[model samples]
Target: MRFPRSSGLLLHPTALPSPWGVGDLGPSAYQFVDFLAAAGQSLWQILPLGPTGYGDSPYQCFSAFAGNPGLISLDHLIQRGLLSYDEVVEASRRYDLNADQVHYGEVLAFKLPLLRHCYERLREGGAPDMAVAFTQFCRDQRAWLDDYALFMTLKEAHDGRSWHDWEAELRTRDPKALAEARTQYAEAFTLQQFFQFLFFQQWLPLKAYANEHQIRIIGDAPIFVAYDSADVWANPELFFLDAEGKPTVVAGVPPDYFSATGQLWGNPLYNWQRMAEDGYAWWIKRLRAAFTQMDILRLDHFRGFAAYWEVPAGEETAINGRWVKGPGAALFKRLEEEFGALPIIAEDLGLITPDVIALRDQFDLPGMKVLQFAFGGGSSNVYLPHHHVPNCVIYSGTHDNNTTVGWFEDLTEEEREVIRGYLGRSGSDIAWDFLRLAMMSVADMAVVPLQDVLRLDARARINTPGRLGGNWGWRFRDDVLNAGLAHGLHFFTEMYGRLPPQPEPDEPAEDATTEDELIYDPVDLATTA
Candidate 1:
């Protein structure tokens, strides 16, 4: 799955500014697409769009296949007559303007009730068109949607307790218990399903707009399922879960730079042998569903495909974990059989072994290169831009790392000296320097974080590794997207020959800017820079 030569910005929709407290698939999202086009970017990469749980991390979702109802646009609802303009105006008035972060608690309290109101109106009005569309969506996605709707409804009913803590019959998914739940909570289930329909309805139009502008969307897919998620509960046979629906062995990383005890993620480990027995049907379906929403997918924790760490379920840390061989080549072989060439970007980060690289190359997948990891050593370091191969994506830093400015500010004297010596600078404008390095790198694609572009620091960091609280809540102010920033990016892109070519002087701009007619520069950054 070869990609055209291009560049993009990494910004989850949650970070987009909106008056409704949290960003949604609304007019602001389309405005973001327009911003990308104006800045000459051809990609818009985002984190998973799933409903977050516990720590509010998108990676740890309630359902891998369901959309986050939190992201459904209230403004869109008003246009559709499901909600009134006054309802939206009142809801917007309730948000705290001074909070620089997303108040998820306040947002959930305010938004959910309004969504329920909209759902009730739809039901009372006998909206056959909406009902038919929702029924058809469910029928087309029954393989996963039915289970997800039921899981969400039950989770709400149980006061948001983990599925493992539900009653023994429901915990083990007894057939009788499931049937009774469906009957008793039918309305709740329908509401959850309707929310997903609305999310997709808004999202598809935004995706089409991006496509029309010659921008491709890259979406993230975590390798493991949350222990308490619908994926684990509905298919207990696919994970290392006990008969009582509790995990026996869990997922985590071995001791690495980020943690001395290693990170115990606590997600249920997959039953690879079982998955292989069925021709990896579950994985195929997961990847297929992801493809429907994104043009290319980034497989998080790609090393897990080669081998994974197995930690006992009750362990407080990952110190006692052991390495177990994953399904590896056989699984990818089957994926290729089902999906043809895989349009995947392997998140080949953290304690990567030769085997992981081997498996990644076997599939012709592009791995990632982070410039922050480069200056710690000499030019031979794999992260150095000069050492990168064409089959890679380069970043200034990832979501888990501090914004480049923050990272630079926190560097020790010795590390700072080393960086100064490497780049022959005294570390002024560290963020922009790194951003320029990334844009000039030889990797096939380069993605700059929105935080780095804004020259923000740790205060605006997206995620901090090993830190549990006060993460994933950062949001940018609307005024941050001013013309100066856009023009600066446009200048840099055009200067480096990374921007799509301008039209002929006599040509009409609209006709010249047809979707298929956009010109993407094909200079291989790996070879040129």
Candidate 2:
């Protein structure tokens, strides 16, 4: 699907400032949307909103279909009578004041119990409408939700061990064992289900607000599922798992520039042939569920659909991986047949082959171009602004990349010289320079990370590949949003013609000088890690 000539900010909700440590769908979210509208943005691109697991990465989620209940707003719960204002105020006191990064363990401990309290209060309130809506949501999503809730409940029961390590009866999903578990932990299972219901409830209203304001939400959908995820445990047959329900081979990449040994992602490889036999029903359902929640979708690791790297089980590194034939065009063909004209943006990065480009273009899906990749090579590099096709989304950098300023600062002198020669500039104000290049590119949509807008250094980096710790925890302070920064962004959006038309008079004005001011320095980048 063709997106309008629009631009947006790339900020995960977790980055938005809040008293609860991590951002949520609270007043801050709505206010952020208002900021977007004021700045003339038509899109609000975010990372996957799934329930994070190990390493607190959204990509490594417990369930692809389930929302992160941690993102549920405690203040909103108070307004709904599920929680009291005093309870929220007391919880806020425990949050770490000095740690800008999310302490997931601490945050989860603080948030989940409160959410549980809310769930119980709502249940006790006996609001028939909410109860009926929750029931309907469960019914509508039973294809995935039931298994996910059960998987989460069971994981808790086993103290968070991988499903393969569970008892043989549960690991193999013996019907009798499952029935017994259902009976034994019915209340816990219901709680898990209720959490997802609340997540969807909160999310729907936010999405509606975006739609009402002429903004659209674009969601990310990673191609591979985590080995320990609910999807794999619930339907082991869909993956290349042995009789013991352990992955015989895993998903990864061959030797790429990012790593000498490549990345052993440790995700279970899908049994494509098995999926094809059922006409890719699992994939169809997954996409359908994603589309229900998001206006547009980005398919991450899109090249995996063309051909994927297979690393044998028990391998410590990706050096022993081999390329295996993926389901390819046949899979997308079936998807289009079922869902019709998917509004997908192909995350066609990393060791892209001719076949990957062919598969991407065949479906007419928009691919991504990162400006950070452009200047390391000559103008002929596909990532260069001049080479960008209209059917692409341009970015200064993605979640996996350092903030553009940090990236430029980290580059070697030789690399900086190459960048200087390519852009015909001294590479001063590197973040804005890259942002300007991306916004002025021929790509249909341009997204600038909020960190780049603030020109933060490596400390504000969202994720680092191959490293496990100290990632996905960055947040902005409320004071970070100021008048000058917003004006500058508005100027760029207006000058580049990426601004969307205002939806209504009462809606925030799209003028550069009228809205709330955001203060940002071209060079005073934050350097904390």
Candidate 3:
């Protein structure tokens, strides 16, 4: 579907500051929504909401369908009488130290125990209406929730070991063993479900509030699933893995700007041939889950859908990888058939090939253009605003790149001079310079990372692709969203005609054909994997 001209902030919920350890779908999230409205933003983009597993990366989640329990608000639990204010207050004190960045370990240590307590309280019949709602939600989401709950319970039972390290019966998902496990870990299973219920329960209202405020949510969905994820464990046949459940081949990009040997993402490669035979059912369900949570979906690694780099499982670097054809238009065609018009943005960054561009254009999905990648060399860079197409979404920087301020600090004189000549601006406030440039670009959408908005340096960097540890932990302070900053954003938004209209009183409208009902195009039709 074609998007209207608009702009927004790319701040993950985890980055939203709260008195609690990590951000949640609590008051802070709602306030963030209000802040977006005040700042004249029509969109609010976030990283995946799935529960992080290894390295606490949102991209490598336990289950694509599950919500991150860590994001549940203890404050809300207190209000519901599931937890005591005093208890949460004490837990808060313990984890309240990280004012600038998320202390994931500390946050998890404090939240998990209290979350388990909340789960126990709910099981004891906390609130009748809420209990009924949770039950129905569990029933509705049973398809993926059943396996995810069992998976989490098992993960806890195995002291957080990968499912492959579990006993053979559970590892191979023997029916008899699973039946016994359900009976044995019945409480654990229920507790996990309770967490999901809490997440969805809280999240739905926040999303509704955004929608009511005339704001649309943009959510991220990684192209590859983590090897140690519940998805891979539950559906082993869908991936390129050995009988022992280790990946025979892995996912990565060959030598690129990010790394000399390229990024060894270490995700298990999908057996696309097998997936295509089944009409990409697993992917459809995954995207279905995503659409339920957000209005628009950004397909991370969009090029991977056309063709992906397959690295040997045992390789330390991605240099030994070979390019393998991906499902491409065939998968998207299936998605369109099942879900109707797709509101998707393609993360068509890196060494994009013609096939990838063709697939994206076929669906008319908006591709990305990052200003950070525009001035490293010359004006020929496609990421430069002059070269960007009107159908694309422009960004000052993305999660993988350093904050624009940090990026400016690291640039050489020649590169800095090139950027200055192009934008015709001084580098004193580099972040805002790029932000203004992106906002004024002809691209239909512009999304600046929250770090750039706050003018934070390396300290607020979200992720550095090849590096390990100390990523995805940055959080804005409570006082960061001051009136001055909001005014600046508002002025630019109005200047560019990107400000969203304020919510008005409800009114009945005339019948109209929605975009989904339009004539379906066969350009995104079935093709070989």
Candidate 2 similarity to native, TM-score: 0.93
lDDT of 1 by residue, 131-151 (tens): 666666666667787899999
Error of 3 at 213 (Å): 0.7
lDDT of 2 by residue, 1-529 (tens): 6778989889999888878878888888988888887777888899999998889999999987889988887777777677888987787688663347777777888888888887787678655656766676677667788899999999999999989889999998899999999999998999998898777777767876786677889899999989898999988999998888889999889886767898888999999999999999888878877887788999999999999999999999999989998999999999899878878999999889999999999989999999888875566898988789999999999999999988888889998998887778888888888878877888999999999989999999999987879999999888877767778888888999898865577877554421111111111111100
Q: How close is candidate 1 to the true structure, as a TM-score?
A: 0.93
lDDT of 3 by residue, 1-529 (tens): 6799999999999987787767778888988888888899999999999999768999999988889998987777787788998988777676654766788888888888898888777778887666776676667677788899999999999999999999999999999999999999999998898888788767766787787777899999999988788899999999998978889999988997657888888899899999999899898888877887889999999999999999988999999999999998899999999888899999999889899989999999999999988886666879888898889999999998999999989989888888888878878889999989999999999999988998889888989876788888888878778788889999999998898764356865434433122112111111100
Q: Which runs in model 2 stand beyond 4 Å of their true positions? A: 94-99, 126-128, 501-529
Task: Please name the candidate that would achieve the greatest TM-score relative to the true structure.
Answer: 3
Clashing pairs in 1: 442-525, 442-526
Name the regions of candidate 1 deviating beyond 4 angstroms.
92-99, 126-128, 500-529
Task: Count clashes in each candidate, considering only residues at least 3 apart in sequence or on different chains.
Answer: 2, 5, 0
Best by lDDT: 3
Off by over 4 Å in 3: 94-97, 501-529
